[model samples]
Target: MTQGFSPTSTRRGTLAGIAAGAATLAMPRIARAQSEIIRIGFPTPLTGPFAAEAKDQVKSAELAVKQINDKGGVAGRKVELLVRDDKLNAGEAATRTLELIEKDKVHAIVGALSSAVQLAVNEVTRARGVIYVSISQSDTINEVKDFSRFTFHEALNPHMTTAAVAKHTFKKGSKIAYLVADYAYGHEMLRGFKRAQEALGATSVGEILHPFGAADYSTFMPRLRSMRPDILCICNFGRDQANAIKQAVDFGMNRQARIVVPVLLHNQRLAIGPEAFDGVVGGANYYWGLEDTIPSAKAFNDAFKAAHDGAYPTDYGAYGYTGVYSLLLAMQKAGGTETDKVIAALEELKYDVAKGPQHYRKCDHQSVQSVLVLESKKKGEMKNPADLFKVLATEPASEDILRTCKELGFPA
Candidate 1:
């Protein structure tokens, strides 16, 4: 999101004069006198249900910061990371973001895994003219009215991921049912899936929205079984996601209907386990196995595995790592910490990160990247326990997907 502002100079003349005189005197020693620190604020759910996911993000960010600083830092400035927990709440996210910007005075901020937290933090950061790069997978984060000059989304939106999965799993005339969480993220994911399904001439046979963190999906499962669609799309996250898939299996819906997950992260995959997810089709921005094809990705995966005892890095980790580095690259291009310049640089960016070719679309500030459509293979078919997927297809990029995003109230 981008924002506009009027430039103002409020420095008192005498103070300005003194400062200028001091700067003149210190010109030769400016490099030594100036603080070499560039602080980055990370606001995420360090506690609560999302703790495991958040921990991966924190680890990834820490690794990235360490790598950057080791490579002579960014333009001779040592990077400093300040982490704050949002506790998975938007209100707390906003409060913590303000603290980071005003009290901590961070140069830029990377944020929480939940879209709600990202949206809340973006609002606060935009209003205050601070740079915020979102690592969350919420399309709404990029739909701000004025396109806040400081905000950028480094993660792939639901539109891209959903469309990719739908295209891979749904054939013409395919019947589908959606079991979505009753929240902004779930709604957005459903919208993306519905759009893609409709474009392929598929029918949405049924739809159900349950509250987040709901324990029992028994009611929803029967509804799904009754519909008996060719495919059942699950657009929930964390425990809700795990429960929905598990119930689908327990209710025998899995035997009748193929399961499709619009956005399944690593933790959720582990939560549901392979037994429940076997033969499932899902979408992801990056998978650790893809690292072999790309050097940077290979390095990242190796380092991440080394640090975490071979645990696979999830979307949260990949996004957090790449998101922070991307923002740092933009800051470098902008030549300073100024918000507008940084946003402009971000919009113009195109780089091959771990996820493959990724560009921050100038029109909507949405990251354009290749999305993987993966099918869950049985445990026996796996080369290793972590190598559980078979690549189905790489979705073709189209302007139409992004064009539809505009109708969804996002900026063109």
Candidate 2:
């Protein structure tokens, strides 16, 4: 399991108090006067393996709501966020999602870090016509045809990340081995990378699946080392990802092989440190250093740094911030909280986020946005620790990838 955020006990308690107090004060009014307030549900893993990411999401969501409310939130209504912790489990996520939709009566929901949780929650939200904005990378969330009435996604899917990594990081005929988590999201990432690798004329040497939250990776490292593939693709997140990379380094695998991570985040960089990350290639939805390329990105980075004492924005934070803002935009565009209208607006979205201009491709509802292919540079090559990555190439939007989703029985 990923480690939970280690905020001081007092601080954690205080934040919980604030959230509870705010919810208590806001819910009654929201229920009585629907036009006066818009309630948004945030169902995320706030206490489990992915807790660090969830903590960041909470902060980002709070910041977004505060900003929106300060500006006289959507359609002259104040925005209220109701948060639930899913413990990063699929069943738990589904239960919490029902509570938020049926009990709390949220107009929309934004969260669930893992694709598995998102998929489970989608089952509930879609059936009831509640708008859901997924931040996870699993392609299945947006590909399901029956859920179009309520589901939309704002993050790049595994296929987008895998295709970018395959095109920019691998050499022709390169031998590859995969160390992936045994979960829906990890499996999707592996499938995407496998297709991309084969398309690039690369050979799949072998694969090892690690159960999520496996503490020690000693058993898996030796098999991967034995394969001696030119590249090792990782498809796990949070502490599991850090542990795998660290264990691989301890087993001297880094000295012999290059790593190709399908999803890399700033928190992972902090966990693994620069020495272990050097020369690694991976894909990210957004990186702070890319701020120079987009002006809105610079403003977001500056605001986040100021608020969090220079904390680097991770994929979780970006998703949380963008998800709330995106939903608000959709609500404004739709003129009200009508589920179908909000979802249609979201599907047709073409906005400039912290990353460049992004469009939610109508076919799969996947964000056709920039996915950064980064090489972890050494300290000597950096102007600062945060300058750890050098952009390689931005993969062009491919209709073929979207077509593949439809071919695989997903909604076109």
Lowest lDDT 10-residue stretch of candidate 2: 1-10
Q: How many backbone clashes can be found in candidate 2?
A: 2
User: lDDT of each structure?
Assistant: 0.77, 0.77
In candidate 1 the C-alpha lDDT for residue 75 amounts to 69
Worst 10 residues of 1 by lDDT: 5-14
List where candidate 1 sits over 4 angstroms from the true fold: 1-34, 144-146, 396-401, 404-412
Q: Name the lDDT value of residue 180 in candidate 1.
A: 91
For residue 55, model 1's alpha carbon misses the true position, in angstroms, by 1.2
Cα lDDT tens digits, model 1, 222-294, are 7788887999999987777778888888888888889999876677777777888888888887778787666
* Model 1: lDDT to the true structure: 0.77
TM-score of each: 0.88, 0.88
